[model samples]
Target: MCRFLEELGVAHHSAGAWHWTSDTYPADAISLRAVTSDNFVVVDITNEEKVIAEVAFPAALLELHEKAIYLHEARQYQVEKMDYPQRKAFVRQVECDYFTDAIDYTQVKILEEFETCPLGAARAAHGEVRVNRQIVGFKKVKFYTNENVGAGALSLPEQEMHTTSFWLHFPDPFLARFSDLTPTEKLNSISGMGNALRTVAALLLMCDPRDFGVSLTEEIRPGLEGFEPNLHLYDSYPGGIGLSAPLYELRPRLLAGALDLIRGCPCEEGCPSCVGPAGETGARAKDGATRILAALVEAGLESGAAPQK
Candidate 1:
């Protein structure tokens, strides 16, 4: 990913030059002069702001920084000026990871096997028919990271891995939104569903403003706190858009409209149906929903304007 970024004209510096001895370094290092490079991009992927304070790079530098982008994308770092309060510096960082192996597909098959198949119409009157089928489909999984001060002491070799899982069900109100969804939206729903999806995506893909770092939160919930390799039995609902498990004609349309509304929303964190009330997922779902919707629209316009397949 770093190489890909370099090819994209991103600016970066090696971590080899970073070595800190004391607290005095962060403040003292700010005064050091920086050499003007070819593209004038400076990338910092470490939590070395104290040292950054001492280094002086030309303002012309693009500052193509790289850290765990997810951590600092939102907040600003405070760099104290000699006689001033502080300076706000905005930086962008892109993070990358290696793929070990594909997720086990058997898990998806298992999910299908356990799906609660809908029963057809029980009995009909003179000319009437009755049918109420349950929906079965996959929802999202959440993930979190911990950067707490003393938490690292609990690890061996100092490592943090994906933790906790929430397979609990969402109430009908949430599912009702996706009753009629398009195939495109259903697949996108995995990572681009409601306001929560957008917020989580931003949380996952967005870099921190300080040093562009990505890490999971310490919070835990089934659908809101674990990483998903593949959709599983625990990840599915009773009625909705599920291709292999079961097919419901109306499910896709229902889901599509609700998702469109939420995704099309225009809010920062989220609004009503999209992200849900702030009490539900931390922020209003509207803001996040709008972001996700914009992405879907853009993708659709690019993919030959193909309808959900």
Candidate 2:
């Protein structure tokens, strides 16, 4: 690789290593993760301007937005102002009963399908996708009770990336079984299942939860109305680090693991450890997701291929 770069006039061989020949450093031109090098500094300006903390670019929109509650050392601080141009947020110490949950909207477009398999009326696939994400709003939930006390709007920039993903596509025939469920209910069910799948995938891959992201949506294709809903588990890196392909090959095991995790949970409805938080995922989310997974398992069994542990 070093010789190739040197021959291409991109680098020079020096001290048994390759160094960039250009004025710019190679590391300065590339990002290691999805996060950018830019950051937002948190300043305490109640009495005098003092740097309190710094938040990364990806998290600043959600954590340092105006009116946001920033937590530091178990102490709560309310954001008084956000200076995006300066990449600074002014905060003041405050007491609050609840933290905030940012609501993000994500859309994934399939660029290429590398592999796929039929599971009853649904298809499991792995592919390249372009993800567009935007943090639009946030909700404040009271402590202990978890009741949403308030909501706030945000106008931040959208984040876009091309990544690899493993997804399950439920066709119309499979969705017909849940015709009785409202659209909202169906969405919640998909959300619950996506959450469970993310958790199981992280454990199976031995990777951090932040290494991948999950989303459920019916808009994988543009200008295609009434498309099937897809549950996507995508690598969080810009171009991916070879995670989705393996996940595609392990679809059966992944489904089985997710099913087992949800079933083993003792929650009556749903909790973050199982499906998702009951407040956001809905009371019937666990049951709905269970039914969907059970149907897939039954389909696998009928085909003489049950998902293995």
Number of the predicted model whose lDDT against the real structure is largest: 2
lDDT for each candidate structure:
0.28, 0.84
TM-score of model 2 vs. true structure:
0.85
* Top candidate by TM-score: 2
- The residue-level lDDT of candidate 2 at 267 comes to 93
The estimated TM-scores of all candidates read 0.22, 0.85
- lDDT by residue (222-282, candidate 1, tens digit) is 5753322221111111222122222122223323454565646565544444544444344
Query: Cα deviation in Å at residue 155, candidate 2?
Result: 1.4
Error of 1 at 253 (Å): 6.9
Off by over 4 Å in 1: 1-192, 195-260, 263-272, 305-309
Model 1 lDDT on a 0 to 1 scale: 0.28
Q: Which digits, one per residue and each the tens of the lDDT, describe model 2 over residues 1-309?
A: 878878888888877877778777777866564456788899998788899787888778878877888998888998999998999999999998998878889898899888777789987888899999998988898889888899998877888999999988987788779877777777788889999999988888899877888888785455666757898999987898899987876777788888898999999999999898887799889988888887876776666543322
